[model samples]
Target: YRVHLEHYMTELLDLTVAAFDYESKTPTYLLTQFLSGIDWSVGTVNLISSIDLKSDKRITILKALTLLAGECKGELDFLENRVVDLKSQIGSNTQLHLRYDKNCDYIEKISDTSQLCTRLYCYGRDSLTIESVNEGIEYLDSAYINNYKYRKEKTIYTNIEVASDLKTYAEAYLAIYELPFLTYKVNLADLAKREIWQHEIINLGDTLRIYDDDLSLNVKVRVKKITKDYVSENIYLEFVNYLYLPKFDNIAEEVAYLSEVISNIVSYDDPTKVSVDAIDDLPTIL
Candidate 1:
């Protein structure tokens, strides 16, 4: 697994920094200020767009960086010699495809919908509401709302005072809450093999495609975690925004069974054939 910035910058003395609001500033500028506050050096930065940071209290430098990244859809790359780089986003432009075969131990998926919210009522500082940005509607709806039969509503409160900034915050919140928590677990020892490693390598935040023809499933997901044991020659990975259930064989069997049931229902004749009794002048079933 690659190193995380939080781990390297974990010194108690260098962790927390005084927060101040920086308006009409690019993310790169805010990042530099936080690093400078902690006396850390900076390197190349490729971030774009101006955003607001509404921090009024002291916050961890990591938290400050996270908020800045989230607002801009960007990520930080901690480089050698304590230099930090901010990019528009992390991961490779060329997505690699991984297929299930003998090397794959299994693929498992997990989903949690307990916190799913289709609509949100967001409140900003000074009694500002999402109503203005939401076309005069009292709340904002997720684009995924139509996927569900009924609406799931939730309320969110933020310290942001600007309408445009509040819109950004609420939309981000809705996007996360509207989707069910999904994760895919996969173990592929073959990825450690020199032959495979030479062809492709995966890292955190990279997008990947999974192919399983027998299960009739092909999905694209982002890598959330990775583990490798060099001594054991094993590699394990976790992905997000993927399908549900576990083990390809079980899912395939369930799908086949459902398909057969539908086939049988379609082929079966109607059982409502009825006849009338002429003498009694009463309806009778045949």
Candidate 2:
């Protein structure tokens, strides 16, 4: 990012043909250039993409990351499987937590919230339309059609519903991990052959959540099992409820303590700017 940023400023701002002191294609220089425009209000780094991809340096880093991804593809694939184990661990821990036998029933709630159920629908058929929407979720088809067909940039989210504000306990739980939920990133395009309904949390969040630094809160992982057993096969069954976070004592102090515990790790490398979501972000506890 620094390298790319420097190149952008040098060329775009007309810095000159000789202001290039460092490698214009390095991440360091791109980051430097990107940080130049950032306004750190109250120690908060507030700025959008510093090194635009068009920059030679930014492109270089992109290629490098891509190359690194290729190099680590084997390990990455192994890690992907580990992600399933992690989820199972999360689910098991949740069960133990919910049991509340010195286990604290908090884990179950966290696991539920962690499962982000993403649904995809294409725009109208005429103008860069959503040729189709994979509403059922697990059932996916037509990779290219599922993805590029409806531009996340152009499409607008409809019927934004607020199903209860972010739970105070859940926020506290999240604050603890600083980065639990490894965010399991996966590529739907490469993973799929024809249609693309697969997604993680990042890209979708860009189009979905237009705010939050234009970045998604979580990363999406596409599970390979395309043909999940449909209800058409099974007759009567229990409503399996998942995709839930957690909430502990509404007490700000306790929650704050949890926040502090995680804060140490979350901002361990950073300058401690990530706001530890306090009890105030929660509803007034009666």
Candidate 3:
């Protein structure tokens, strides 16, 4: 008992420190490794202490991630101000139009494959807030697109879906995109006839389709990504709401602690709300 308790106590101390080190949203993969190694079979005293410490550690990391998001957003706004200033500098020899849209470049700075979840957290102290598609609506109202616009309401009929193990995500996505929102008014015939939505479709790729209850209504959408595991796609549906983007500020904050995505989807899956800033990834907004 003495040896076991002593060893666990020491481990608890080390883990506590590890957690604090990551309190600022720094994504050190080594910490994930360390967490995977935690036995947690120690006596009550050590086990309890470890759990409390870990929770605190994760919370701090989340706050740090939020700060990082703010920092990235600040960079974007700074660039926007510069563009405005440039637009104001119209001289006599000015061209027909001043296409001063460098926003894409700033967006790329943040969206660079490098600034993905882990790296994003570690990039700065004052991170950005990852709001849900519903929560970030106000931000997009000022012309910053929060959602993508579909070419038109298009739907293809198929008993296919993309996730089995991910029931919550699958269901939530369906609820958000499935004609239920638009009252199943999407046009099924036009989608198949013109196949504009399917224009981007390739073998083993995701294509957004609009589904109507009776070919009377139209719901616009785009298919984002397909599951690598589901080949037949018979019961696996993959889709993204061209109109709704789920914000993940808290979720992003938690990324520093979680080594996987098991909990992320569960945290926020309600489909009723739409977020405009979530359109950051898509090319166009309708």
Candidate 4:
């Protein structure tokens, strides 16, 4: 018996120092690495940090690998032998080893690949047992043609409110399909003294509102994860809103209401609510 294993390997190439700064007199370095391999063409590291310490510290490189895995399409494994520390000030350039393989856990299962071309179709259900014309094919003969006849009535359909306008509906549909998330870094030095003492600046479950002037986009999100760099005193916040899957009864009405709310806040020029260069430098605002 002949079996083929569909597998790919991705490796982090030479590390380059992106940023070097001093925080509270502590020397800090931020390094970036380019990842390339069989499956992945080119990938850039989002954030990296390195700092000098009195004693040697073991840093787990899995976090970086894990982030890369999420961006990749299929399953991937890190090539330990290929990983090399081209340049470093903290310690020796020894080859790092990983105990377990890293793979992309985020997988969206679909019923049929061909049905992806069709906009109106129901998914997320077993196609084999259920009679579904949108399932692509029932059975293929020697000629590679489907034996079953295509019938729209036989297929399971999802009942959703159809918007009148195509453009407006498209925006509403996309918003529900692709939920938005925000990620940004926060520096401690830019924050006020009183706000600095509070540890819940980037804490999870905290609600945040982000406004983009150029795009005219306003998103209300909750902090999902917080990654803090103690040496550099920099905190990375990842926020996401679980507001997808609109109510089936009034999709257009909901979309219109949301649009109105965003419009009101952006157009409102309330002096008390809006700040014009008030440099108190609160950590929560940052």
* Model number with the top lDDT: 1
lDDT of 1 at 26: 89
Residue-by-residue lDDT tens digits, candidate 3, 69-136 = 23222111012111110111111221111011310111000111121111110111232222232244
lDDT of 2 by residue, 27-143 (tens): 333333433433211111222222212423333322332232222221111122111010111111110001122211111112232322223322221322222222333221221
Arrange candidates by TM-score, highest first: which order? 1, 4, 3, 2
Instruction: Order the numbered candidates by lDDT, best leading.
Output: 1, 4, 3, 2
Candidate with best TM-score: 1
Model 4 residue 119 distance off true place after TM-score fit, in angstroms: 2.6
Off by over 4 Å in 2: 1-245, 249-257, 272-286
Instruction: Report the candidate with higher TM-score, 2 versus 4.
Output: 4
Q: Work out the TM-score per prediction.
A: 0.56, 0.17, 0.21, 0.25
Task: Please give the CA lDDT of all the candidate structures.
Answer: 0.63, 0.24, 0.25, 0.29
The digit string of per-residue lDDT tens for model 4 on 163-241 reads: 2222233322322322122333222231222464443333344554444444343444444444554454444555443
- For residue 253, model 3's alpha carbon misses the true position, in angstroms, by 18
List runs of model 1 lying over 4 Å from the truth.
Answer: 1-14, 37-44, 79-81, 115-181, 190-196, 213-216, 242-286
lDDT of 1 by residue, 1-286 (tens): 6442444555523487776887889877888887885546676668767877778899888788777776665666655467677776555534577667745666886787888888888787778886776678868777678889999889877566766566665654554456776667888774535775665677766776767776554766777777775566667888775222111233335334333322332212432211111111211111
Question: How much is 283 displaced in model 1, in angstroms?
Answer: 63
RMSD of each: 18.1, 25.5, 23.5, 22.6
Clashes of each: 0, 40, 35, 0
